[model samples]
Target: MLFRVALATGLALFITQIKLDFFESYLYDMRVRLTPVPTTSGNIQIIEVTPETVEYFKGIPKAEHHKKLMEWLIPLAPRAIVYDINFDEILGSEKNKKEFARVMESFHQLFVLTNFLEMRGEEGKLKLSEPYEKIKLFSGPKSSDTANFAKDGVTRRMMINYQDQVMLHPFLASQINTEIVDKFKIKGLFDFLETDQVYIRFRPTGTYAKIPFHEAYKGLISTQAFKDKIVLIGHNLELSEKDYLMTPYSRSSIAMTTTEMHANMFDTLILNNAISKAPQFVNTLITILISIVTVYIVFALSPAMGLFIIILLFISYLLISYFLFWPFGIWISMAHPLLAIFLCYYFFIPYRLIIENRRSWEYYQKNKLLRQVEELKTNFISMMSHDLKTPIARIKGMTDVIINDGFTVSPIQREALDTIRSSSDDLLKFINSILNYAKIESQGVELHLQSKDPNNLLTDVIRKHEFLAKVKKISIETEFEPLFPIKIDPELMKQVFSNLIENAIKYSPEETIIKVISKEIDGMVVVRISDSGLGIPAQELPNLFMKFYRSANAKSSPIKGSGLGLYLAKYFTELHGGRIFVESVYGQGTDFVVELPQN
Candidate 1:
């Protein structure tokens, strides 16, 4: 069990480190769906560079179009104007650059997106894709780099910094809100990006207010709409596939635009609500704990119970994870914990059961060998008992001849001979008891069923035991009902009754009465033999019919007998479709009851 738990924990850790994307992606998407929709900050607005606007500037150069758009936006006195479009190449018009630079210089803060492009001639060199030199003169020292994507090619995190010639260029979102960045002491771009990468808390799509570039340029939207607003100018229309990026909110049927993604990043930075990955050690601990608990439950409980517990734990863990992401903004790894549970349930549990089953089979085989040895011992004792009975019978016959065949002997010799004869008779009775018990144990009772009156059978049994009863001065009384004639093995029934009566006589004090009662009830024959002798001890009554099992009280008595009589009696009675039980008190007498099917 320990090994399996360790194996599962180690396996979960390894899988978590490697991060199988197929599973993790699904989990991440689930967390995204669970996140509450973000409220729109009304301070931020998007001005989409639509296809209509692109077509409107068909006759004009792209730089000229930007110049015209900026010319219109500059009069609004916006707090900041952010351009999501990149200007990598130089527009070959000095006149357009001067005009754009003049319009950009009029604004209080103007930020243009830049990207770090790999230089073609250099193996490991990066250069900034900047706007025109005249345009850059007015844009200020920091240009936001627009290069941030997860390993899965999704834009979930923003590149807070980019390295160019040993210099750091902060991300656009960070540059827009330098106070938040400095306040949080955010450092190390990718570390901060990956570890503190915020899940985009998105408002419903199409909810962020947008104005068409042509509408803005044509003076259709009033300047009041842009007053005191942070204007983000970018293409909202699907100009090409490269213009779009996948996000957590991206579904199978829809993808979020890069402009909307920027808005989300901007809003996240403003709110300071970036979701972060839980620490590696914490995740590992959670995975290991889950693995160990799953293994323990599977081994400790029954299969059905174990399955129920596993499912409950799984659902509870999921709920916890959902709560953490939805409310607390923490994205702990769910893949590994879920995998650990899966392997423990689907793999480890079945393996343990197989091992247990093998052990059980081995145990059964060992017990079978022991039972065979016991059977051999029983058979040997039975054969020896049969052989001794004959010799004892011959001894009795010789003793009888010597004592009774016209021989005169002293009283002492006659008494000695009688004692020897009586001892031999007792020995023969013990041997017969052993043989009868062994016969039932080694083989089985074979009954010869005959229709017999219950009263007549009881009478015969009582007559057989009358001498023994008289020796003890015990009265044997009978109460018989008009029992219907039933089929039974007469010899076995006689033995059963004789054993009960003899036991009663042996245990009872002088003049104690032993009562035998027979009756019919509910289509069954019932016979009850109750004795006022020393009743069986309450603790010993349960095992009273087991072979050779003598009670504590019986062991201290002077009664001379093997303990096989009652065992054989119960065996024979049950073979004829009957049940036997004894009810007794510690000092009171016992009542042995036998019931048989009437058929």
Candidate 2:
């Protein structure tokens, strides 16, 4: 336990201190390699303007060819059209340019793809600047500012916004979403925080709608359907290299193509569900930590207790993950962490149980039957001691009164009687504590459940403890609310509260305050008793209510206690179907709360 604690603390500190970006990158690559991602992009018909298509159409007249393409596009209404080809040169005649412009105007959904070029000259550089929708920069501002390419100087990603009446990007489909929004009158932003990839609904599967560019001019395929569909005018132009990017659909040459990128973006805008970047490192660390903590607990705890703790931890993990992921569409994988816990338990638990059994056997062999006999003797003595305690206390009190007030005695005799009385009181307390433990073991304490007001019960308990608090020079404050009555045994519950308060008083320093508050929460009555005293160690918390279990810090304290008080209190509370719990930070004092269901 100590080693694991130290290791976790030291490693956390070390990880914080180190800059391991390169190493992390390597790990990330390795992890990605370990997990295979298969590409499932369906085939899309490519209308390539290759040398063959150009030759077949006679000669490649750029303007005339574009006109012919548009004619073909006007009929085959594709899901979208991307004009990947650049019109930067304006090489054709002014009349031809106007004709091409008219063709562009005729069709509305065509995504005319272009680039956001970044050129750096010694003093000045001259370049035409244009904004288009879906044609904007692909990158963020920081990357755009300092990014100058070595090859044909161009910015891969652009920073621009798209609104109707203005094209924002150099991409083909950037205009589609804005146009749709304008047409549909849809308002507000769609958040794609968790999901990454968007799924496009339909595209022509085979070569029915697609034909060679030259063939289009030759009336090889019908151009009837493209009248209203998006048309992309881009080339398999060798001079122009497409922007390569990763989309959930495809990641190869297709992603690089200008038309496809527009299609991908458009699909995402429409679908609104894209695969998001899950926090891999964060989830991984959390899972592993939880597993490790579970492992430690399993190893350190007794079987029954360990099983209970495991159940609790599992429930906590489920609730946390459910709240964190399901409602918000976040995906944190529970498989690995839960698997680690199960795997560790699968191997470690049997090994632990075996070792524990062997140790128990060895101890049994050493003591033979003596240990059993001694235990039985101690139990008997404890029971007898407890049975005689109340009467003995009464007799001692009467004797003290008689010796002090009624009879004249020597100083030595009086001192002896005082010592006897003190000893008798100590013995009586020990006996009562043991008797409580025995009663719990035998299920001798029966609860009489009734509609008990929590506030009134707290008040009564506080009243009984006020004199004790005064003796310790402590202030006891009670804050009670109008609470619903809960089913509980008043006598047993009073003992529970009294034991807890006594312990609080015993541990608290003089001039300190012990505050008790009772309130109702979600069909349950909660009583909280907070004290200004040294807190229990975090490690000791799990064992706090266990029989004969005393914390190291508590044992070292000057305050004397039987430790059975809390154990008995817990037992009695459980008899009434209630729970007691504590929250504390070392040196920051503690808060003990008891809850009973209002049923």
Candidate 3:
């Protein structure tokens, strides 16, 4: 147990560490894969960059498009307007870049684009040019990248950190924040500084509300203004190639574009408690708990059952992580924890099987010996019974003759003779049962293969047992369905039915009903003989057909029976390629069913 526990703990820890560093990234990817975007606070708003606007000034003059965006911003007097476009370098006429920059300045609500880089520097570096000094930048901790390196030196879980400083307000953030501050006529960032940042929570992936950019631009939205809110600049169009990411969540496309990558980073900021670090001890404890649980389950269950449990547990873990982790800022490493659980299970199984092997072997050997002893006793009983049959029959015949021929005996002497004759007949029948049981073991009797009508056979058996029923003051009832004749050995079949009916009559109470029914059930001929008798116990049912095995009820009864009737009946029933079974309840009655296949 200790060994299994230790192994489980180790596997869980290894998995947990991997999750903290990398698997969490996959979770983030999954979140993004659920289509993400930002909505303005409280109201519906539009930022239109339409084809018509592009055509309005003859092929979307760059200066004119910027001016139109300015126009839209001023009229709406919106909370904030974010320009997704960036102007890092002058691509068109340098004058046009300057003009666009001046228009952004005029709006005062608009924030323009600037880039920042974080990189390692040479120890004794030459002075950089002025062109490199204009970009906005902020510094924080040197990015710590963690990944796995294989023997071939290939890295998995890529984390790139090429800058010593990051852009605090990337182009979109600058634009949106600028618009909000200008429209409200109040400084931004200061109020947000003293207050806890409100995280923008969203429903999970596959559940986000998608509003088309065209519809928003066309004034079809519920609300038409954002008086005091931050607006996000992103795409909803399919043709736009600006969105893509390579994370596990980005399964739909080949890859995510650079703009989408930035969008995800911004989402991380909005949902500020994005990354979490669970204490090492907590992770370790959880690992241990899961391992121990899995090991215990595996040891307790059968292999098939254990596998089923493991599958359920694995699914449960995924579900818990799916629902719980993101909400609590808890990032559980799904793969590693499960791996640990299974590893523990695997280790425990072999150990458990090995430990139980000796106990199992002892049990098997004891049962085998008990079975052999039972067989020997059955054989002995059968042999002795056969040996006694001839003498008992002879004695019965001679006594009958002496009584019938009027040997000049007194009345009392005649009565005694009659009693002796009856006892001899009973003894003879008992011996015949033993002989039949022994005969079942011998492969001597050739089954007379013939197609026998089951309905006729059922009727005959019921008729023959009617006398025994009469003696008990029991009524025998029958119901037979016309069925196709089934191939069987008639003589063996008769012996089978005789024993069953006799046992029923011998065991049943007086003045009760014995029902015999025959029907075609599932392409087989089924004969059910039921009697209202002192029934067998539930626990003894499995051993009912064992040779010389009688139920507890039978053993305690006054009825003169050899306990070989059902045993012999079972053998003969099987000999004709049929099955026999009994259903009984204590203090109720017993029903014996003989099912013979159609073929």
TM-scores for the candidates: 0.79, 0.37, 0.54
All candidates: CA RMSD (Å) = 5.4, 19.8, 10.0
Whole-model alpha-carbon lDDT for candidate 3? 0.58
Q: Which 10-residue span in candidate 1 carries the lowest summed lDDT?
A: 137-146
lDDT of 2 at 498: 82
lDDT scores of the candidates, listed in order:
0.72, 0.58, 0.58
Q: Candidate 1 on 127-168: residue-level lDDT in tens?
A: 233334433311112212234222455545554422222111
Compose the digit string of candidate 2's lDDT tens values, residues 153-239: 211222223221223231223344444334222212222222112212212122123445676656676554344444434344444
Task: Pull out the clashing pairs in model 1.
Answer: none
Off by over 4 Å in 3: 1-273, 325-329, 349-368, 390-408, 438-491, 497-557, 577-599
Clashing pairs in 3: 29-249, 79-226, 118-162, 118-163, 118-164, 119-163, 119-164, 244-256, 244-257, 245-256
How many clashing pairs in candidate 3?
10
What would the per-residue lDDT of candidate 3 be over residues 469-579, giving only the tens digit for each residue?
897899988888888888988777887887888788888889998888889988888989999987888999999999888777777777777777888778777877889
Residue 588 miss distance in model 2 (angstroms): 1.1
